[model samples]
Target: MTPGIPGFRHARLPGADGVQLSTAIGGSGSPVVLLHGFPQTHLMWRHVAARLATEHTVICPDLRGYGASDKPAATSPDVYAKRAMAADVVSLVAALGHDRFALVGHDRGALVAFRAGLDHPETVTHLGVLDVVPTLDMWNVLHGVSAAVGYHLFLMAQPPGLPETMIANSADVFFGSFLDAWACDPAAIPDGVRAAYLRASAAAVPSIVADYRASAGIDVAHDQADFDAGSQFAMPVTVVQQDWGAQLGYDAAQVWRAWAPDLDHRLTRAGHFMAEEAPDEIAEAIRELLAR
Candidate 1:
């Protein structure tokens, strides 16, 4: 195990789109793949992945376009679709010589994990989706100011160049909005950590837009395919989310129920970045889910 973060070794992963990616892996035993959300990298799972690694082999990788991954020139949201991302995880695990493993994701990562569970049900033994519902549910729930909270989704999904330029001009302000506004406790994001996210996001403008752009386009289509197929994950599943968002019309868990029949849903008081703001609680949930 790694000295401090049980799972934090840097590795390269081959993505489904023929892109080689930078990944962080640690821990030992049953393999566990950790996926990060938007504007963040694999580092988001630092704490939870570490704790899980103490018993299970934990792996956290930067999604295709976010961190040190190959930023392919793909404007068609299909290129960045959840199905493609899920394929990336499958290939990544097989690259590590595992036929199947446990899967966990937060924010955007949660969507990718959802796709993985739906598309390759045989490869995921268990799944943990944190703070998100399926893409189709999210689209229907967007109304009034709730829609404003995710304005970037529509903005970034635009024709490109413009969103990239605007985000670059105010990268810190753009990325920090969630880190600051959505935190149950603002202190969860220390200056250094906040700076790290800001720096990484600022440097990757085009890929950043592609990541969000994928949501409105191919991602939704992927989710619809699952919905049309009436697909649901057969593996044991756990969903941990903030109750406030669900109450505000997001209705996250309700959507999750349609996709995952076997799930332990827990609503908490933590903010959006539950893994960082409530590591202990998040770790407990992960541990319990993995044990099951």
Candidate 2:
């Protein structure tokens, strides 16, 4: 059996367009939703969610097309677009009786949360993003040798069939590679959790590829339009990330500032999987963001 956040109860909550999100909800008081990143499920937030649940209602959901969530076919570009995923989040929260909540995400989920803050500013009281810039800015900054770090992004961004076939043929290796490489401490993800992540990701290859493909296409268009409109996040926002800019040749905080004016951008020594690798730091940063 898959392990879950200990005190959290699981549910299949309605998301946008009849999609159902596999959600783990716990605690009480003000609501806060945590979205997990690529190649991983909501389980990644297990540590952080437990910490936050002591004072806040913490909701962790496998985004549409991921983990136990409904994997709707990506018949259209918008299907897996962060905009759509963001909508799923909004609808899911509303279904859980929250009109507004603090929204936080890691990696791909951060993209969705970023979009949510832009599209649903009135509904998100606070925003937290981990380890990623917006899609447009991400594409803008990656170039030459530095771009090598994001090879999977390029591979999965391809036009469907090839990427899906390649990954599915070697699913465990493909999924496990990220879990192994991105964690600063391998022990941070216990053997069981690592197995679960690989299992879930391997089963969702097609939808996962579609998600990345959307980021390369429609997601970028949406982000570009927002940037053109000077749309910025209108909530207390906190971003925790490694000093990726130092390695990739761009100012990470400055890149984020373009989209978030009320931003508290932080540099963490933790790995890409910071929530798992350094839960206390992540939880404390989230608490600080909530306080603001």
Stretches > 4 Å off in candidate 2 = none
Task: Extract clashing residue pairs from model 1.
Answer: 7-26, 28-57
Which lDDT tens digits does candidate 1 get at residues 182-257?
8888787677667777777777778878877888877888778778988889999999988875347645666778
Q: Each candidate's TM vs. the true structure?
A: 0.94, 0.99
- Candidate 2 yields a Cα-based lDDT of 0.94
User: How close to the true structure is residue 171 of candidate 2, measured as C-alpha lDDT?
Assistant: 98
Best by lDDT: 2
